[model samples]
Target chain A: MQDFLTIDALSKYYANGFEALKSINLRVKESEILALLGPNGAGKTTLISTICGISKFTSGKITLAGHDIIKNYRAARKMIGMVPQELSLESFETVMNTLRFSRGLFGKAPNDSYLEELLEQLSLLDKRNSQILELSGGMKRRLSIAKALSHEPQLLFLDEPTAGVDVELRKDMWLLVRHLRNEGVTVILTTHYIEEAEEIADRVGIIDKGQLLLVEEKESLMQRLGQKQLTIELQNRLEELPTKLSDYDIVLAADRQSLNYTYNMRSGRTGINQILSSLTQSGIIIKDLQTKQSSLEDIFMSLVNETAK
Target chain B: MNYYGIKAIYKFEIARFFRTLFQSFVSPVIATSLYFVVFGAAIGSRIQEVDGVSYGSFIVPGLIMLTVITQSISNGSFGIFFPKFIGTIYELLSAPVNFFEIVLGYVGAAATKSLFIGLVILGTSTLFVEFNVIYPGLMILFLILTCVSFALLGFILGIWAKNFEQLQLVPLLIVTPMVFLGGSFYSISMLSPFWQTVSLFNPVVYLISGFRWCFFGISDVSITTSLLAVFSFMTLCLAIIAWIFKSGWQLRT
Candidate 1:
């Protein structure tokens, strides 16, 4: 896949000398879903704003479809669409008119059929004639998506697209994002929801304090950092871990009825067989056993914590 | 040139104006009619003529100028200000449209709106007083220039203003007073020499003077000077707007 968007050494600074975005570099491939995960004030919105040309960058270069964002902004901007974090919409305008206005703003000819199809996909077809103020919060979020996609932009930026919504709507938004990617619209979304990134993102970029910590394939990221835990339930309660199990990374449960062993899946030897033999020699009778894999949330927390230190 | 982008913004703004028909259109017309009742009937009864024209008829040009100038500013300022206030301006800023297209859309719509209101007030004034436009073409030219120039100023105000209070401050405190004391009601000639000389500095004076010349062929200042003043004001406004877009001062920041 070709890089549809390339950002090199981009930095943004306020007049008061606050660094909103540090020297950042990234490339987004066509038809790929890239999720940017960050905490509050992590410069997620600022990055998206700069790419969409809403905020001016102090230095560095960004190009969309091989056009420099600043020098060739018209061509670059025409190919890009952004759904802002805030539900900013014309309250008095009807849903359909809002979409039409957005499409026209991007210099596209009128295509009501395309717009109607978008509305239908977002379940907003019934509310096309309804004014924005009349819609519910979820409906407004959906309308923002429809507006962004109205121009058929090759690149779409969804900034916290499901920030405040119900579980059902969040799922719907995820589905829509996946559907957009399938339609060959490269999607870059900023979110703090680990589940959202884990569920839909093909690649995940972790950012902290205006710096991108890492960007890698989601599965690779999980596999490289992920840890697995094995639980051994004992029939007889133990006051502490036996000296025989000290060689392994194992801990006795606080309740004294079970033992937990942590190991890396990527390692050639997990030592499960040796640990079981050792436990048997120590006269520990295992009544039940279970294992659990570390979730992406755990990996994310550890990475952020490492950076915080 | 992004003509479609300009048309989109222009149409959106015009639609908003039509949506609030009473506030945008009817209210100004009603206010102008009341001015005729109060100033024309009440004041005109005492002063029968001023500069060889009926007191009722002489104020016609000034009345239209007042509405056109203020309405242009209000319409222009609010058109951009409301979007900023609601944060919807992000769409405008992020769109493929350039600053020129954006300004044309907003300022053009504002001018068109003020022009409509000015023409309506002119028509409504006829019910109370009779007036003839000696140079109908020049009258419209002045009207349009005022609308466009003042609308450009309003666009600047919209971008510069931080809040609603700030948005209304200039129009209320500065512009409205300028129009009133700018000889909108009485000729500057009525003032003593000292005050009359001071009134020459008021830009609105030139606008009213030039517009009045279109109607009765009488003006407080020469037609050439009036035209020069209008052009200079417009040039200054365009320069400021250009700077705003170039620096990304308020809108982009």
Candidate 2:
């Protein structure tokens, strides 16, 4: 109950009998940033929407800062700030008024200084007087965050805050999320970008087909599911690995100019030296070589596949 | 009640209304004026009087009712519909505001726009033909109730409509024709007995007759019946809206 947010036995069944969420239970630690990663239509949005009270649940309860979402809906809602996945803004409204209006919607009194600081933090001070329609797409996304932060909710939900954003804006958003977490605001964001979760999430929750596959600390999830790969590019393309090189398990590049060897990092014998020596003995010329560490994407795929099986 | 939330939405709607002044205010006023020109002057010149009231003055209340009812619905429907259309309703729905406050913000702003446009049309009508309100208080009351009720209807239509064609279907083909046949241009008493009886069933008749009664002390239906009719219709609209919110019908998925 003392945790920032909690969902217990939550289920949502639409009128058409499509089950969007099934008996989901989870807890969000205070002042931490948790990212929910999933492919499209995997109930990521449904989960956030249900928790935010945008969509009603058929059964179960949600509590925000100990306020029951159903019985004390207003109080529960007041503790949450959500930036919806949709790029829906009042295009005619200026950035300043949009923040003011959003703050007012949350039943908060006017505080221009706090709003100005939020805008400054989001790098939107210059566009404060500009209508949202006049701003760039990236700027609009930033404004959405500024609007959500106006009421200073204890828990913030950024639903794909940088889904279509450019690299620069995404970096800027990552910094903002870190700053918010440092300020004691717990953030729960849903992202299709695995790299985003890896970049900012203290804890990552992978969901697929309306099921939460796993929730774990970022470092542990990566260590347990991660694999490393070694790639060698030959100076010349070959149809297949030569006979002497065949003993080393390898994957040929689609273009037939490269080979990749993958192995568990925790294993004592990687056998990489044997493979390299064998390639040299087989008279295959290696023009370049690179190694890649497994990212959250691999873990996510394996987790999704494991659950599907 | 979320007073500030209501004000936020209300102000936003008002700003949107003002932003598109030519479309929202001027166009309706011009259209109402054209109705005055065509029906009041052009046609009235041919027929001097209808039921002892000057022909030009007789159509005044009906024309206002016609515009007010349509304006309320259009403004109300579009006010909420555009958000749903553009997917902005998600943000509003996610806000801390309750369903009643959301409705109040949208429908209230819509009703205000209808009232504004209705008054503008009334002012425009004065330039064509002079008229009087025998019961000024009742005229305002009916005006408010009609605007609010029809606005609620439009909000429902906005929610239920899946496309633009469906949105205009009721107001254009159904409601507009009902208003014209409901005695906007001519008195129901001027019609034959069979046709007049059918006109009684058109709900707009009571609204127009009640509104017109306040103007010329003459009406097709009693003022009490007209008031009751509009009140009950408003109550029905409210009930439907309540049900929509409770069931999370189209709003939640």
Candidate 3:
């Protein structure tokens, strides 16, 4: 399928030979939310910066809405809006002027009605005339989004949009992002919040150490790589796993009250039955059992660690 | 450059400058007035005339040009510096505006500000000492040249500046000293012949001499020399700024 935004073989190397991004390729479909998950210095911001033409890429090609990022930067940039992490707004300008100016920056015709709607949507209507420095942190964050949306861009990039905001404001931002996607605006969000990706992303891409590790639909990624852990309460505190149970790959708890086994969901054999039979053969009885499905956070951690290796 | 995009950024910067109109418009006047009082009046009372004009009246053109040079640099540099430091430059770089539009918008607004401030100081100096602009056309020409020259200089300073301390380095250490030693308060003729020869090395001297020539109809340096220096300096600065914008020197890296 054709993508609304396509990044091919993107790479960046600073003057001092620091490689920021390495051969990252991504395709974002129209009107979908793609959560880019990564640890610090994982090249998330660098990718966004390159795509927006703010930072020069060492080598790569990016196309936005069918326009080349370098050859047709103006048209490509006109279709995309970005909200940076920092709330670096003009301290003295009114909120309305900020949005109006941002819209004009895109060469868009003045549409006070649209500006008004954006202000209202961001809950900034009452503060439209207020100075940016006077607004609260959350208000400033909202204003950044309002400014980005003011241009009526088809593609929106949020670089850690809710990194340090309060929980309530984060929820508001999430709903607002969802609303934007519903309106047919594709959102490419970079975030450290794994749960936020789980809650809102239609697709997730894990990037680590300047390389893209994986990109897949959220549910499909979970189903393909998710693991289930089985914990069995033991009848006795065994000093070690019995020889018969050793082949089951079961781990004994420190207090000897539990045995743990982990298996991939996609694998046909869960190993729970085999482990139970091995335990029975070793004359062990389980008193209680519980299971835990691998969470998005767990998958993210393991993926990042594996990539590091 | 997109015309509308340049207009928008220009308006945004102008609005920001005027948001505290009392501070932006009034502070320069007050500072200039203090200089006029202390240096133009008190100091001029002791020193004799330079050429045929009173020492106080002699410095008016230089002082006015001084204000234009310093303020244009500060306004242009800080207007962009703070944004870059606080990370809002990312927002601008990501916008649809091209680099030319960005430079034009910023440098244009900064020039406008210096022009406004120059006129204000010119009007204020009238109350202290009476002096006629011998060549109004030339005076306006020099005013714009000085503004654009310093504005481009400031544009370079803005990109080169990395922090608040770096922002203050040029205006305070380099520019202010140049304005002082460039003969803002005294004529280079007052110095020894060798010193007079050395004063010709200071770029600000030509800026001041050219501006003062427009008012008093005479200059310490030849009018042709001053005009040539101003034009050459402006051209050099413009070339450097255009290169910086083209290469995305400090802005992109």
i-RMS for every candidate: 0.7, 1.2, 1.3
Better of 1 and 3 by TM-score: 1
After superposing candidate 1, which stretches have Cα over 4 Å from the reference? A228-261, A264-277, A283-309
Reference-based TM-score, model 3: 0.88
User: Which residue pairs show collisions in model 2?
Assistant: none
Candidate 3 per-residue lDDT over residues A163-252, each given as its tens digit: 888889989999999999999999999998777887899999988779898998988775655578889998788788878776765788
For model 1, state the Cα shift of residue A287 in Å.
16
True contacts kept of each: 0.83, 0.62, 0.71
Better candidate by lDDT, 1 or 3 = 1
**Winner by DockQ:** 1
Error of 2 at B70 (Å): 1.0
Candidate 3: regions farther than 4 A off: A231-260, A263-283, A287-309, B38-46
TM-score of each: 0.91, 0.88, 0.88
